[model samples]
Target: MTTSTESPCWFTSSYSDHGGQCVEVATNLPGIIPVRDSKTPGGPVLNFRAEAFAAFVAGIKAP
Candidate 1:
């Protein structure tokens, strides 16, 4: 289980341009995905396994 401190780059969705209410995602880590609130960068981060993260994103995009 990794933490936000481990991720090097944090990026918010391009859709955030319209509004600031978007989640940020950090990748390039060893085997985890770091996610946090775009509004609170220093806030808590949620870590997920790569496979789990992919599934989560797929779920969000699924109809």
Candidate 2:
């Protein structure tokens, strides 16, 4: 399991543009991508494998 005590550096997409449904992702951690709702910074965070997150993003980018 990937573990990191380092704080996450959250980044929301520029396309979020005032959308209340935005999600933020942290790529600072090793081997995992941490995701949290932009509207709820103190809320629960979902952790996903970096590779899996990469694939998901790729799929979304695909036409």
Candidate 3:
């Protein structure tokens, strides 16, 4: 778990326009992808391997 302060700028997913219930992502880190709740900017962050995070996103969008 990483803190929001430790990550660079984070951006909400485009899908977030549908509602505010979306996760924010920061990819400035070399090998880590920091994710946090958009509603809670200063909340806990879940760090995942960059590759793993990409795969997860792919899976979610897979039909």
Instruction: Give the candidate number with the greatest lDDT.
Output: 2
Clashes of each: 0, 0, 0
How should the candidates be ordered by TM-score, best one leading? 2, 1, 3
lDDT of 1 by residue, 7-38 (tens): 45888877578376888887768778889888
Local distance difference test scores for all models: 0.80, 0.89, 0.81
Q: What are the models' TM-scores?
A: 0.78, 0.86, 0.77
Candidate 1 TM-score, C-alpha based: 0.78
Per-residue lDDT over 1-63 for candidate 2, one digit per residue giving the tens place of the 0 to 100 score:
344658998888888886779999988889899999999999999999999999999999999
Write out the backbone clash pairs for model 3: none
- List ranges where model 2 is wrong by over 4 Å: 1-5
Given candidate 2, what's the lDDT at residue 63? 100
Which residue pairs overlap in candidate 1's backbone?
Answer: none
Ten contiguous residues with the weakest lDDT in model 2: 1-10
